[model samples]
Target: MATFALIHGAGDAGWYWHLVEAELRGRGHDTVAPDLPCDDDAAGLVEYADAVVRAVGDRTGNLVVVGQSLGGFTAPLVCERVPATLLVLVAPMIPAPGEAVTDYFANTGYDEEPGGDTIAVFYQDVPPALAAAAVEHGRHQSEARLGEPSPLTTWPGVPTRVVLGRDDRLFPPQYLRRVTHDRLGITPDEIDSGHTPALSRPRELAALLDSYVEAVARV
Candidate 1:
């Protein structure tokens, strides 16, 4: 069974992947969703990747590292440290080497895009109760690392995939398409959900992830 290293986004905890974890576990795969030190004033992307590596320990087998949103910045770092078999980015803030996280918006022209209400952007498709719980589960995302450049000098050699939320408003589909292609020369696979698909469409999300494993095994 492959071990899925699930990394959450900015201000989010491991709980963000609970539903997806349950689904994966039920399908006979192991998953690790480590709570990043997002609230710590001293912790940055390196520390975030360290948490995931520590959680992984010595487990051996296919290692699929999945990162969401801001976690995108840390996922490749993990792949660089570990023998990751696949790197999957879910509605990610795909980063450039040496680019500060804070500069991503302006660099990608996200700042020029039309904006939406926070809730409407992130949780429009998520159920109200679960979305509320997601909000409560959020922590204070420290700005300590916002100005630090991403440490990845080049993309990891591991196979990579990008998944896009078709209805996402925070990073709209069109925007993500442009960014993904521009940065990675790849077209993302689209899903019929908003930004937080783990909460809004766990089963579908899990199935998609599972399919990747199957596809990789054939290679």
Candidate 2:
């Protein structure tokens, strides 16, 4: 069995991964989903990483750290403190040394803002009921989190994989592909969902994660 530590993106809590968590536990794997302090004024990347590390305390297993969206930034920091078997990024924001999240967006050429419908941009493929609930329950994210410089000097030495949503409007497939290649020297695998796959396509996401773990075990 493997342990999956799921880190959510900005403006989201661990509840965002509830579906994915259910799917993973159903497959007999251990899972931890930490609620990041994205809305708190005092919390930044370091605090975010600390929450994830605390959730992962003393777990002995094949540990995998999975990050989604802005979580891409926080997950690597956790890998620096913990022993992870692999790091899986889901539509992540790849940061350079001392780069802030705001700078990363501009650097990545994501020039267009959402045309007023977050559901269209983020949850196009999700079920309507779930999407509506998510929109209603979404929390306000702190802007301070975006300006903090990422503390990583280099990518963590653990094995890594990037997964992109083929229909993601927020971060298009081609853009993520280019960034992944330029930054991580790898290509991302694609799924048939939008930005928030854990809500829209949890089963598929879980299967892909399990497959990655199996593939890594063989090596």
Candidate 3:
């Protein structure tokens, strides 16, 4: 079984991945979803990666590192420190080496895109009760990490994959297509959901993750 080291995005803790974790565990895989120090102004990208590495502790074999949204920047750094079998990005903000997190939106033209309603953009497909809880669970994201350049000097050598939600408003599908292509030379696999697919479509997300393990085995 593969161990999925699931990393959540900005302002969110490991709680963001709770449902997806359940689905992955049900499929008989071990999973680690750590609460990042996103609220701590002192915590930067290195600290972010440190939390995940420590959470992983020394388990070996078939590590699949999955990152969502801003977690994208931290995931690649984890691969550099772990024997990750594959790196999966779910609606991620793919980063360039040395690019600061704050610069990401403007550098990628995300700032120019028209914004949408908060509910419609991020939690449109999520269950109402759960969505409310998610909002309540959010923490204050700090600028310490956002202001620093991503310390990934180079992308890790592990095989990589990108997944994008077709109905995503926060990061529109068309926009992500260009970002993924320009940054990673990849065409993301599309899913029928909004930005937070783990909460909105956990089963389908789990299945897609499982398929990645199968694909790696084939290689």
Candidate 4:
């Protein structure tokens, strides 16, 4: 069984992965979902990567690291420090060298203006009850962390995959496809969900992850 280290997006905690973690565990895989110190003024990408590395401590097995949204910036750093078999990015923010998350929006042609409705952007495909709970439990993300430049000069050597939410209003599939091709040089696989699929479509997400792992093993 592979150990899956799941990293959540901005303003989110490890609790966001509860559903997906349970699903993976049911499928007999070990999982680690660490709460990132995104709100801490002192924590940046290095600190985030350190947290993930600590969570995966001393595990010996095939390991898969999955990052969602802003967690994408941290995942590769973890892979650089550890030996991950695969790195999967879910509706992720692909950061260029020396580019901060704030700069990534305009660089990728993503809408940088604020004031969009959260429900329309993130919860469109999620269940109402769960989405409501997520909004209520959400914490503030630190600008210091988001504004910091990524430490990576190159992508990690680990095999990588990108999973795009087909209906994601925040990062639409077409936009993700273009960005993934240009940045990661791969075509992303699509899923039928919105941005928060771990909470909204855990079973499907888990199955997709399992398929990716099996496919990677064959190669």
For all candidates, what are the clash counts? 0, 0, 0, 0
Judged by lDDT against the true structure, how good is candidate 1? 0.91
Name the weakest run of 10 consecutive residues (lDDT summed) in model 1.
Answer: 111-120
Q: Total clashes, candidate 1? A: 0
lDDT of 3: 0.92
- At residue 62, give the lDDT of candidate 3: 88
174 Cα displacement, candidate 1 (Å): 0.5
Residue pairs of candidate 4 with colliding backbone atoms: none
lDDT of 4 by residue, 93-201 (tens): 9878778888998899886342368776888777889888888867789987677778888888999999999888888888899999999898998889989899889
Estimate TM-scores for all models: 0.96, 0.97, 0.97, 0.95
Task: Report each candidate's C-alpha RMSD, comma-separated, in the order given.
Answer: 1.2, 1.1, 1.2, 1.5
Error of 4 at 168 (Å): 0.4
Local accuracy of candidate 2 as per-residue lDDT tens digits, 1-219: 899999999898898899999999999899999899889989889999999999999874689999999999998998999999999999888888788888888887776565648888888899999999888767888987678788988899999999999988888888899999999999899999899999999999999999999999999
Q: Which stretches of candidate 2 lie above 4 Å from their native place?
A: none
lDDT of all predictions, in order shown? 0.91, 0.90, 0.92, 0.89
Question: Among all windows of ten consecutive residues in candidate 4, which has the lowest summed lDDT?
Answer: 111-120
Residues 92-167, candidate 1: write the lDDT tens digits. 9999988889999989988534366656778889989898999899899999877999888999998889999998
